[model samples]
Target chain A: MAAIQGEVSWFCCGTAWGPCGTAGGGACGTCKSGNYQHAWPNTSDACYAITHPDTCGLSMSRRGCGFRHYTTNLCNGARVGTTIADCGPQTDLFCGERTCCGSACGSNRIIDLTPAAFSAIGSLSVGLRPCSVDTV
Target chain B: MPQTLDRRRLLATAALGGVVGATGLGSLAPDAAFAAEAAAIEPGAPDPNFVEGRISKISGHLLLVLGSDTVLHSIRITDGTSIWKLHPTTFDQVAIGDGLYARGVRLPDGTLAADSVWVNIVNLHAHIAAVGRNLLHLDHKGQRIVAHVVQGRSAAVYNGTPAVSDLSLLRVGRHVQVLGAWHPDTNEIDIATVYAAA
Candidate 1:
């Protein structure tokens, strides 16, 4: 069996009917199909779009327009509306041009040149290349 | 499905599946010096069940619509999905060249919401359709469409931010956009994402 890395559980709660903690390492509160949250709170707010404005992590907005903040986006268009704007300011130390790949595909290691909309936890991820960029 | 140009969008997407890391929007700014026209094209309005299209023809109540693959489908019109059935009255009065919107279900017989029908013919895409008070209307690919008019003062609706500014410029015959849901039981479509394009 392919052992998952530390504290990774696709099963919403990591445990049955329980809140995930460091054991499950889940940020979501509720783990149901229609329920999307981290550490279920008492707020009545509905599930914010996964590509919500707050999820941008940068100035980018999830308006789904070609809004590029960090110059990267999510895997599929599902997360397309997110922004990677914050990733740019931190690019100076990584590479003159975010050429460092975090995980995902081992192909190349570098932050995408163009802005994208993916969720970043700690480090910047690399792999996305626009259709036609002079660098790519 | 609309074909993707498949460049940056694809690469970014590729990175996502391999790892959960998404780049912050700021880092890519440096490359913006040379990045092509990646203005982050907004997606069409949120589509529930994804059923709505531009109109092509209208001869009286028998309107010809550009459906999947741009095939002209002879559409019969109706209106509203009220439980008390009060919405039905407005729907039956539909006319030609109206930039109409609808929602229904695909039945086993290959017909859509055939047994029942529900719709809202007030007005759609009126800003982009270049319609007059005679009922919203516009022409697309040699097809004419009349839409419902949803007139109101330019309100600050959520687009991307609270600073995105006023949207009072929306007009008819100007490539409008809308997002919302559809119901098969009443065969009705409710507008949600409604915006006019240049």
Candidate 2:
């Protein structure tokens, strides 16, 4: 994989806030909102069954817990390094949805960062941004 | 299982050079190589499940916040909502000016019914400009940031190694990534982990 391009969003975990209360620190049980972490669609079989990025024409490798990946915000040229903390993005639900920055754009939600990781590159309120993910 | 895990780690580490080198863009900085791999997707589709910003006001259980992009959001909290400041804390620990990232259901009335909120958490890439007794002077994108190392809490990962609580290996002027809790409206952070090249 040269670099996987896709839409990036943020998620909450590790006993903070509501709705996220039951997120249960992700599938890895090591996810913390204060940590540099992200949710990859293909952490495990059960995770793949839930996110299914393949349904959206995106093929992600099974990078399990603590696997390192660098995510760059195409819009601002900002990048952050994070470890796989859980499984996520529910790719099929937002199949055709796109996120862009300047002339750079990525389609289909393939990655979700923790608040700490996402804010390091771009503002979280933007919700979705075009990004590239690569193992570092 | 251990052998399988070891193989995966080897592959992942090798991929760092293998796939990245295959791009024919070896001269590029690691960050630049990552950027060059950019591909565009569908644009302007908002994420309906999340919100981020600073708490401008606390009205009962509702929090009025101003997003980093200047958008205003009204977030509703309940007993079920989990709030974290430095750790797993209660809503009473929240204060005005505290930065928050919330994930939950968006109400028809345009409010976000938050289920979880993290306060003042930050991930930063910086150069270790200097080191003091228990502090790391970091240079983040040309800006200086002070990071405090907490005993029993602060950890470091050398190269791609597992994390350990030892700052003795950190050298000055090395590029590192820091994950920590922000002190809110300041240039300081409480370090949780520092990732560095061995």
Candidate 3:
């Protein structure tokens, strides 16, 4: 705790902080004392600012065409954790209780593309003939 | 001392397959054909020692079979035989449902040290009970039989429709005719064909 001013790494940085190296391979001279190298994942539409602001909003809407009956829940449940449905009841090609968002034909179920209407999301693939359906 | 005695008898059983010591001493699938095959395997032939058997259970490829006198014989098709003229690859080609036949040498412990094992080698008209992986578990009238496809051996579709190069046609739920070899040690029948039939 002496009176050494310009001798420490922090003391040197206390001035105009040195250029910070971005996690991306390029270097940024505007770095401050506490700055560290980090890179943007480049997945979203916007580059992450120094404050890590989320420029890309949520893809799925809460009440719009993006939300379907049990479709999102099924996929999310399948990818995230254990699913309680017997996938056969859905179809042979897929696993779970919910069918794809589509239309229904004889010897087949419904097939529709309500989710694909979202501008940011990709269109759903063509639905197939389900092998099993609950007979009512 | 029975283990030692069994080993001694087993070593004696390796005498060129000519030991004819006992008629029904060993073998899992106890069929009259096995006696003929054993006799056929005795004399000079190209790899006559090879055969098939059923897995009483599996701990890896090492299967325990109720072989020959209902003895739980430990068997493994390690380093199986193949005919490069017939099959290009042998890895993961074998299963329990497909018929198979192997012609090779026998070891002292009553195991088939096959130099060449053929899948779907023998043919039979049998009823299918269950199907799992290369194993077509079947019941021939009153007998419990196993039709297996060896790793390298190919199978013939239908009963007389030449041989099929692909194994995708084999299914587990269909009753059919199979042609192949029987290995007593492993208690597996090497399958050549599987479908709707006897």
Candidate 4:
């Protein structure tokens, strides 16, 4: 699949504590805060209805649970591979949101990685980073 | 530049050794080690090795923290520990009452041997409601925030480009993710990096 450019953020899932305690096992019922996992906005019709990437004038492919995608942190050139474990990012809420590293910039929030996957490519403290998502 | 390089080298060496503050064989990167440690915790559970809270006390290299959930944590800082306040700093710069997020190894005694700690760091997603000289009015989650741009320190990254100090490209109505230092108990923040589209 062609690469999708957008903002990437993180969420804690699985059995979690504190504010993350309510995240549960995600939409796939298999998410873990420590796993290399991610949430795709269009995991299902219900998921797509909520995320609504099209409302932001972006077309995103519908990928299902366990589908693999690679996310690159534009700031540092760091990358990680992860599987879909949930549906998320409520994309319509933050339409027109954009982030960039240099010449590479992504518009809108497209993907949310698990904490373990996110911290691998970027600092959790930063919360969000410009990213490119590819199927390679 | 040499000093920065040396510090990075030291950190790399420490990470490669997989001994942040205790003896262990793990990944060759500090983040990798942290990921490995996190995996050991039960799924959907609070990470045992990751602690987030405010520093209530600091004695020597140890930090006494009161978690947001009311849990108490003892975090031990080591030479290998990388600290970031606004920028990369030393342990001494970590002051009391600063909020922090630490990732490391949880020792058998329940103390966390921190590999990395971020103090007063906040990453916010907001829209540019207005722009003024050296400042931006942000609307975050329906709340207004005053974000100040620290000259020379604040940078902007446009369209996946390298960061630059010029922020004139920021436009009202555009959404942005800001990484900066938060003033305790305030809606104000000092911008470190602003990521947005041109």
- Candidate 1: list runs displaced more than 4 Å: A1-136, B1-63, B74-89, B92-95, B98-101, B114-153, B158-198
TM-score of chain B of 1: 0.28
Higher-ranked by DockQ: 1 or 2: 2
**Cα lDDT of model 1 by residue, A18-46, tens digit:** 01111232222212111111221111223
TM-score of every prediction relative to native? 0.24, 0.50, 0.23, 0.67
Error of 1 at A60 (Å): 11
Per-residue alpha-carbon lDDT of model 4 for A1-136, expressed as tens digits? 8988898988766663323445678899988765678899999999999889999898999989989888877766667788899997878766776665556677788998876677656677566777889998
Looking at model 3, residue A67 earns an lDDT score of 16
Model with the higher lDDT, candidate 1 or 2: 2
Summed backbone clashes in each candidate are 90, 19, 60, 19
The order by descending lDDT is 4, 2, 3, 1
How far out, in Å, is residue B137 in model 4? 1.6
TM-score of chain A of 2: 0.95
Report the number of the highest-DockQ candidate: 4
Higher lDDT: candidate 2 or 3? Answer: 2
Model 2 lDDT per residue over A14-122, tens place: 6543223345577888887646788888999998997888888887888888888888888767777788888886776556665555578887777888876665555
Better of 1 and 3 by DockQ: 1
lDDT of 3 by residue, B1-198 (tens): 233224323433433343433323333221111212212111111122323333345465444544212334444444322321123235365554332333333565665533333433333334567767767677653566766667656454442233465656545555454544445334456654343311
By DockQ thresholds, what CAPRI class is model 3? Answer: incorrect
In model 2, which regions exceed 4 Å deviation?
A1-136, B1-44
Minimal lDDT window, size 10, model 2 chain A: A15-24
- Find the candidate with the highest TM-score and give its number: 4
